[model samples]
Structure formats: C-alpha cells, structure tokens
Target: MGNRTIIPFGPQHPVLPEPIHLDLVLDDETVVEAIPSIGYIHRGLEKLVEKKDYLQYTYVAERICGICSFMHGMGYCMSVESIMGVEIPERAAFLRTMWAELSRLQSHFLWMGLLADAFGFESLFMHAWRVRERILDIFEQTTGGRVIFSVCDIGGVRKDANAQALDKILSVMDTLEAETKELTQVFLNDSSVKHRTCGLGMLSGQDAIALGAVGPMARASGVDLDMRKLGYAAYGKLSFEPVVETAGDCYARTAVRIREIFQSIDLIRQCVRLMPEGDVIVKVKGNPDGEYFTRLEQPRGEVIYYSKANGTKFLDRVRVRTPTFANIPALLETLKGCTLADVPVLILTIDPCISCTER
Candidate 1:
C-alpha cells in the first residue's frame, strides 16, 4: 500500500475513441483505486433543443455520439411524439426498429475492434473493424453518412429502405454474421483473452442495479432490463428477451455482445420479413407543450432522453442521460483491488464513449 501511486489514464487515452480521464492508483501493477473524470467534450447539446426546431434537432441529437447515433435520434423522436400524442405508422415504427438493430450491430462490432486493440490483438482488431466497415458502407449508401446518420424524424424516419436496397442490405448482413461467427471462436478459445478478461472487473447484479448500470453492463451482471421489451417503435411486434450473463466479468460482457450481434442479425431478418409499406415520415405541425421521457437500449447501455416543450419551435428544456455517465460509479468501484494490467481491458468492455455523456 505504501508503494501505491496514482496515475492519470486519460482525457486523451490512445485506446479510447472519446475523451475521459481515469485516476488509477496503482502499486506494483495492481490497482488500488479508480477515479473517473468527464466533461471534456461537453457541447451542451441538450440546451440546444430550446433553439432548434424539433424537425431539425434530429441532426443535433445524432451528434450525441457516433456509435449509438440512431438510438439517440430515435429516443428524442419517441419522447417528442409522446408529447404530441400521435402514433407513427406501423411501417415507420418497424423501420425504426430495423435501423436501431443495425445501429447496435455495428456498434458492437466497433466495440469488439476497440476491445481487441486494447489487448494488443492488432490483427483481430483489424478483422473486427473490417466487418464494422462493411456495415458503415451500407449506412452510407442508405442514409448518406456512415457515422452520423440523421435518418430519424419526429414522426418517423427521414428516409425509407426500398425493397431492392433492403434486400441487398439483408444479404450483406447474412454474410457478415457468418464471418463474425467464425471470429467468435478466436475470442472464446484464445488463452490470452481468457487470462486477461475472464476474472477481471467482476460486477454483481445487486451492485449493477444499485449503481443504475444500463445496457450490456447490467445485462452482463445478470440484470435483464431491456427497453426493447417495453415495445417501443417496432420492437413491440418483435419477440425477444434481454441477454444476461451471471459471471459479470469482462469475459461475460464480451460474450454478451457477441451474442447480441447474432440477435441483431435475427432482428433485422425479422424486420425484413414483416416490414409493411407506408409513408416514411409524417409532418409534425405543432410545437411540443408537455413533458416526456424516452429510453432505449444502446449498444453500451440504457440511454434516456427528456424533453419539456412550451408550445414553441424551441423546447422549454431538454436533458440527455447517457449510459457511460451512469456506469462511471460502477466502473470506479470495479477498479478497486484489480491489477493495472486489467484496467484497460475492464474499461474497454464498457465501451466508454465519453462524448455520449459529456455532451
């Protein structure tokens, strides 16, 4: 204990895509305590809601973070729709679900690549991102941008996936899933991954819930609260449950995400089979004059959007509660008594995108 020293891990970590600083107290490669720091990229996006019209704010919402861009847009739209008390067309809801699952698929792939990179698996990292890149290419063709696809509108989606393009997308996803399945063996069977992540950063179900952990973190810890089960958007028509793992270690989290990729593929396939035809979006004519809350299962965890409208183009107030922000307390708790070698891997498993929170 006398030899322990505290070190700053980030705000500009090489392995992390977003800026967040961790104060790690270490003694001979063992972590004694962990402290989290945020607010580096705070853009005050929520405050912008008061200035931008609900229709145009979709683009602003997408900027909350690149990985879960679709979820952010969808969440905002869902909340505002609740205020307006208007139901979107069934076809539009289904379209939102298809794209949301697609967002999750690519997000998990991107996280896998980042996880691989953290463990020094350069080839595996590239391999994972290769699959992610394929998805991004599809996103680009469909929504005109790969990272920040402003595809959601207040009533529904900004654009529709036509039959031919939708079919092509499904075919591409099928091939990607097959390739990803083969790679899963590499993560599960590799001794290096097991040694580094198997027993690292264990989070118990009680602690996860108490700390308000969301998404894969809570699911990995054995809590099964998936917002999709609430039947928002097209998810009500879909049949599935949240994936859970009892171990609550980095290995469990990795397994959960790998399984979710398969699930995403299944979800997209279902959307294609059950998709009906209708207008992609309906014009929202009036201003919001009520308070509403919306939640979604982003690839990282649960995301929340809240809005208060004053019957104007501008909202009275808007608040975004991101998963990474909520998971900070749990992360700090897990780092205690862990080896320094385990620090980066534990953080990677959470896929912390500080931009999602700080903004």
Candidate 2:
C-alpha cells in the first residue's frame, strides 16, 4: 500500500449544503475508509415535544428541515392523527399528497443544481435552480409560505387550494414538465457528466441492502424500496412506479432523482384531477393517549415519525428517523475505493441533509 493520509471532509465544505463531518482515510489519493461524525447541528427538536403541545408541535416539526418541511409536519400530524383516530377529510388527503409531490420536485431540482455546480457547469446549475423557482412560486401562491408551510395541521391541512389555485398548479406542471426535460437532458446525455459520474463510487445492490440505504440511494441500486408504495397519503390512488437503475453508481443515483422529478409532476396532476370537495380539516379533539408511528416518503427518502402521548397536551416523546441517517452507512461504503477528488460528487449523490439527520 502507498503511504496513508487522513483527510477530513466537511463539518463545513464548499460542496456540502449542510454540516456533515467525515474522516476520510486514504492511501495516496484513493479513499480507504470514511468515518462519519454527526450531531453538528442537532437542535434537539424532537425533545421539544415535552414543551410544545401536540398540536403546536406541528410547526416545530416543520422546522426540522427546510427542504422537506411540509412532509415533516405532515408526518408528525399523521402520527398524532393515527393515535387519536382522527380521519382527515378526503380532500385534505389529496391536498397533502399534492404538496408532498411538489416538495419532491423542488428538492430534486435543488439537488440537480448542486450536482451541476459540483460539475463546474455554472450555467446548468443556474438553469436548474431557475426552474426550481417556479415550483417555489406555486408553493407561495397556494400555501402562503414558500418553505415552512404551516398548512399541514394535526387533523388535516390548515388551508385548501381553490379551483383557481388547482388550475394554476396544473398549468405550471405543464410548463415545468417541458422545461425539466430539456434541463435534465444535459445531466443524462452530456459526455462530461457521464465521464465524471458513470461507474464512479459504485455500491452494489446487496451492499446497499446490507447498509440500509433508503430513497434514491437504494432505488438506484435496484433495492425497489419506496415508502410511498405503502399507500400512505394519496399514493394508493396514484399510479406510478419507483424509478430504479441497477448500476448502483453515481450516474444511476442521479438518474433516479432525475426521473423522480417528472414522477412528482405527474402525481401532482393526479391529485388535482381527483381532488375531492369538502372541508380541508376535521376537528381533532382530546390529547393522544397512545404512541403511533407514521412513515412517509420525503424527497430524500423514507422518514419515520414516532409520537408518544400520555393523554396530555404535551407529547411524551417525538422521535424522527430521517433517511440521511439511514443512508450514512451506505455512503461510507461507497466512499471506499473512490479517489479523493470524487468525494464531493459521491456525497452529493446521497443528497445528504444533515439538518434533517441531526435534527
């Protein structure tokens, strides 16, 4: 073996959007092992359940992660609703599904931009984010808040999209679909992108399963796992398949996310077409007496929310298992045998959200 060196990659780095520290053990320029150290931005949001009432904690849950904020609030609310046996209105369920899919689109777009930036394709990065702004504009028009939408409540959504809003969403989807196809073509077909990503940071399907990879990371490796298939929210009514690629490399992972962007657009359209007419929320009475676990597919991957209540206003505990946390082990596995120069791209492939993981 060549002389070994240790390189630390990010609690803060130019490439990473969130704080995640990894100690990269290297023999010359190739990484031999990657040891992760989390908890840099641990805000102890889960413990806030003790102080915040179950209803009020929905906002707190939304604060867990900005990109997947809607799903975080929705997941927390779903847990409380399940525990209380509060069946939300059908219209509310469809609305939640629409927002969830929109969240996925924005997240995947942001990731594509970051990946483009990592490739040093400045124009491509700007083009990707410019498309993402349209999605955010839709969020602002519908939910009133672009990021931390307080629309999702304990029993159901706090707000409803009117006919005009729904029509606008459909129109926006039509435009975005065309725009995204053109944008993603560069990532999918560009020789430079393929040269940088193809066969790099490979993780076999078996290794991905063993390491507990989730979301695009697992799907890219042909693991065929998607929490949405469990029929949560309006997913049961929606017709779609999880995007998968068997190569289990950086290219495959990128491909999965790229396809998922279009999938999310289709899902939103379905939600609009099948939207029910009724009140958005049901009155949720009384405190939750038992614990319940809710799983939802966040943009990054599967997020599990566990809520325990003691028949009080405040919850006994709120625990969240974020996808980034689950995929860390798999990320370390991929880092091995990769050159130091490829580390940033490899890390971005997992789409790490340390804010979500460390929350």
Candidate 3:
C-alpha cells in the first residue's frame, strides 16, 4: 500500500469565501477521505431569541448570512406567522415571491463569479459579479439595503415597490438577462472550465438521496426535489420546473445553477406582470404560543426554520437547519477519490455557506 498523508485545508484558504476546515487524507495526491470541521464563526444568533422580542428579532434573523439575509428573515417570520395563525395578504405574498427571485439571481451570480475565480478565469469572474451588482442595485432601490434587507417582517414585507420602481426592475431584468446569458455561455461552453469541472466529484442519485443533499447539489445528481414545489410564497401560482442534471459531477452542479439564474429572471417577470393591487402587509396581533416549522427554498438549498413560543413576546427557542449543513455529508462523499488539486472546486460546487451553516 502507498503511504498515506493527512493535509489540513481551509479555516483560512485563498479559494474559500468563508471558513471551513477539512483534514484531507491523501495517498499520492489522491484524496482517500476528508474530515470536515466547522463552527469557527458561530455567533449564537439562534440563542438570542430569548433576549429579543419576536417582532424585533427580524433584524437579527437577517444577519445570519449576508448572502441569504432576506430569506433568513422571511423564513423566521413565516415560522412565527404560522404559529400565530396569521395569513399575509395576497399582494404581500406576490411581493415576497418577487424579492425571493431577485435574491436567487444575485446569489447565483455571486456563485458563478466565485466559481470562475476558482478556475482562474479572472475576467469571467468580474463579468459575473458585474451582473450581480445590478440585482443589488435593485434591492437598494426597493428595500433600502443591498445585503441585509430588513424589509421582511412578521405579517408581510415592510417595503413596497412603486410603479416606477417596478418599471425600473423590469428594465434592469431585461438588461441583465442579455448580459448574463453571454456570461454563462463561457461557463457552459469553455473548454477549460469543462476540463476542470466535468466528470469530477461524481455523486450518484441514490448516494445524494442517502446523504440528504438539497438544492442544486441534489438536483444535479438527478434527485428531483425542490422545496419550492411545496407551494410556499406564491410558488404554486407560478409555472416552472426545477433544473436537473443527471451527471452528478461538478459541471452538472454548475449547469444547474446557471439555468436557475434564468429561471429566477422568468419568475421575477411573472411576479411583476401578475402582481395584485392591495396592501403589502397585514396587522399581526398577539404573540405566538405554539411551536412551528417553516421551510423555504433558499439559493443554496432548502432551509428549515423552527420556532417555539410560550405566549410571550420572547420566543423559547429558534433553530435553523441550513442547506450547507445538510450538504456536508454529500460534499464529503464527493471528495473521495478526487485529486488534491480539485478540492477547492469540489467544495465550491456545493456552494458552501459556512456562515449560514454555523449560525
């Protein structure tokens, strides 16, 4: 047998956007096993539910991760709203759906840029992030914040897009669709990109299911599961299908995310065209007295929010099951047999959001 060596990766790596350490067991540059360690940046945000009132905790929830901030706040509010039996207005639901799609767009663009950077395609990375900037601009114009948008509230969203704002959103979407299509073509067609990603980190459908992979990670492995199909937040009213790829490799995951960017654009257009005329928020009275679970399709994957209340403004418990946590097993599975040089790309394929996972 060849001699085995253990190499420590991450917690501070040039490729990783967040901290995630992996002890890679290798035999002559081929990874035989990988051990992951997280929690370097855990902030105990979940435990703050006891100190912060349920209403005031919206801002705290949004701080779980800057990339998925709006969805974090939205998910927490949905859990409390379910416990309180509060039904948001139809217009509010539509607006939430629109904003959620925009969030997805910005996130996928960010991922594309990071992926390009990992592959050493600096120009491609800049182009992808340039497209992302437009989406953030839209967020700032509507919600007053680019990253941690505190607009998502208990009953509904706090902000509404006026007619002019909505028009600008559509105009920007049109421009982005054209620019993003060009940017994604390089990722899809470039020989170098395919060489680095294609056929690397293979995970079968059964293995993905067994490992509890979610979002694009699972979908790329041919497991047809999207939490949006649960009909939460006006998804039932929209017509679309989840993007799936059967290869179960790094390229497949990249392709799934690329297609999802277009899907988000289409969903946003549908929301703008079909938005109803009514209040964006409804009056939510009284504190929650029951335990509830809420699930939503975040950009990374399916995230679950659990809240337990004791009929007081302060919640007894608040817990989040982030997608990065769910996909770690699948990630470890993919790491086996891959060359050490491919480690960063494999990790990026899962789109590891360490902040969200550790929070």
Candidate 4:
C-alpha cells in the first residue's frame, strides 16, 4: 500500500466539542484507516472510588461528564446497590427513572442542537436549545440543579416528585414537544440538510456489532441491542421498545435520537403514574463487601459500571465502559469512503461525547 496522508483529527479542534485524537490515514479526501487515541479527559475518577466511600462519590461521578452527569451517578449507585443487596424503595426507583428519562431528553436535545450548529444551521441550534432549556427548568425546579442534578443517593433518590411539580413538568413537556416538532420539521424536510447527512456515514449491522457499537450508533446500523432490556431501576416496569433503523448511516442515527426524545416523554409519564408512595432512601449500615457490574442506557448508549469493595469504606476497584469509547471503531469505519465535506455530519451522527469517552 502506498503511504497515505496522516491527519490527526482531535485533542483540540473546532468541530470536536471534546478531546479524542484520531489518526486518519487518507488517500486524498478518502479515509483509508483510522486509529483512535483516548485518555485526555481521564481524571482517575475510577481510582478515586478506592479512596472515597460509596455514598460520598456521587459528586465525583457528577464530574465524569457534565452533560451526562446524572447518568454517571445513577450508574455508580446501581452498581453499589447491586453489591450491597440493598432494596431501594419502589418510589425511589420510579423517581430515579423519571430523572433518567429527563436526563436523556435534555442530552438528546443538546446533541440535536450541536448537530445543527455543526451544519451552520444557527437558528435550528437556538430552537433546539430553547426547548431543551424547558426540560432543564423542570430539573432545576425538582432537583435544584440544571446540569448536575445530584439527587441520587446510594440506596435511593434524595427527593420526591411533588404533585404540583409533576403537573408543571408534564405541562412543560407537552409544550416543549409541540414546539420541538415544529422546529424539527425544518431539519427533516430540508433538502440541503438531507443531502449533507443521509448517506455520509454508513456502517452495516455486522460491522457495528463486531466493533461493539452502542447507543444510537448501533441502533442506526440496525443492531437491536439496548441495555434497557436488562431492566435496571424501573425500566422493567416501563413499556417500550428500542428505536431502530436499518439504514446504518448518518440519517438513521439522527432518526433514532429524534424518535427517542418522544420515547423519553412517554417514559417519564409512565414513571410518574407508577410512582409508589414511600420514603426515597433505605439506610445502609456498613461498607460494600463484594464486586458488582451494572448497566445503564444513557443518552449516548449502553454504559457499564463495575465496582469491587472490600468491606471497608474504600472500594477495591471501579471501572466504567462509556458509550463513545465503545463506539470508536464504528466511528472510524464511517469516516472511510466519505468525502471531506461529509466529515462533520458523520461525526455529529455518532453524537461523539469524547468527554465521556476519555473520562
């Protein structure tokens, strides 16, 4: 093979909102092969688990990725709960589920807005963020934080969803959904947007699975895997199916997330209806004494958190498998055979949260 031009894709770049370096081997404008480098954002959060008590590490988990802060906390809590054999209250499970759906909703909205911004659709970006802010408003009203809603405790949630506040959240969701639909129509029907996105990055089902693709990336490629099927928290009670598209392209990824936002709305409603009246937390008397692995379906995809405790305040080990890190192989494949102009759209489709990946 002739020596291909090597291009470093990130670590710092305007199009990339996070740090992930991809060494792309190219023939003119066509990518031949891609090698990914991570760890730039790693802050030894996992190692910190060995020193900090399980309950006290929620704040540290919140720093894993600011945008996906809640999911990080939930993942860690779920892992520890599994290890401790603590039974969380049903109400606590439902509350956490509602918060999880809200987190997914807002994160997807943020991705949609960033996609618009990538394509220079500034107005669309503003419209998406505007609707997202309404969801964030609901979060702040309930949990007292817009981004890092650290409402999750070790055995349960820290607060309850009051009736008045629930009504307000539902009302806001209804209005936000309506407005979002109106604005999304422009992206869906726009000829230019379609031209730029539709076939830019194509990954077949076999390839997506072989590379261990997760979240929207795998869904777009027609893989039927979803961590929610494992049913942690209240997902077992929620009725819904994963969003899937067989196109295996940028358009399919976009379609999966857009449809998921609507799914999140329905999920939040179900959690509220099924919410049991009880205390939010169950007290734990001692340190965790075993290892546990818990999976969660974050907005990006399936995330797994593993922890090993030694019957002491400090953990023996903690490991996390973030979505973007798992999807990097799929990302490289999509970049191949695509024209230079299609790079941004393809990258955005994976909805790369390299911050989460590197962390």
Off by over 4 Å in 1: none
| Model 2 regions more than 4 Å off | none
* Stretch of 10 with least lDDT, candidate 2: 9-18
lDDT of 4 by residue, 22-82 (tens): 7877888877777788888877777787677777887788778888898899999888888
- Which segments of candidate 4 are over 4 A away from where they belong? 1-4
TM-score per candidate: 0.97, 0.98, 0.99, 0.96
Error of 4 at 124 (Å): 0.9
lDDT for each candidate structure:
0.86, 0.92, 0.92, 0.85
TM-score of 1: 0.97
Residues 1-359, model 2: lDDT tens digits? 88999999888888887888889999999999999888889999988888888888999999999999999999999999999999999999999999999999999999999988887888999999999999999999999998889999988899989999999999999999999999999999999999989999889999988998899999999999999999988899999998989999999999999999999998999999999899999998888999998988998899999989899899899999999999988988888899998888898989988899888
What lDDT score goes with residue 287 in model 2?
81
The per-candidate count of clashes, in order, stands at 1, 0, 0, 1
- Best by lDDT, which number? 3
Tens-place lDDT per residue, model 1, 1-359, is 46878899988778886778888888878888787777789888888876788877878988888788889989988999999987888888988898889899998988888899999899999999888888888788778988888888888887888888888888998899889988888887799878878988999999999988888899999999788888889888887878888899999999999999999999999998999988888877788789998988888888889988888888888889889888888888888888877777888887888888888
Which ten contiguous residues of candidate 3 have the minimum total lDDT?
10-19
When sorted by lDDT, best at the front, the candidate numbers are 3, 2, 1, 4
Q: Write the per-residue lDDT of candidate 3 for residues 245-279, one digit (tens) a residue.
A: 99999999999999999999999999998898989
Q: For candidate 3, what is the lDDT?
A: 0.92
Give candidate 3 misplaced runs (Cα > 4 Å): none
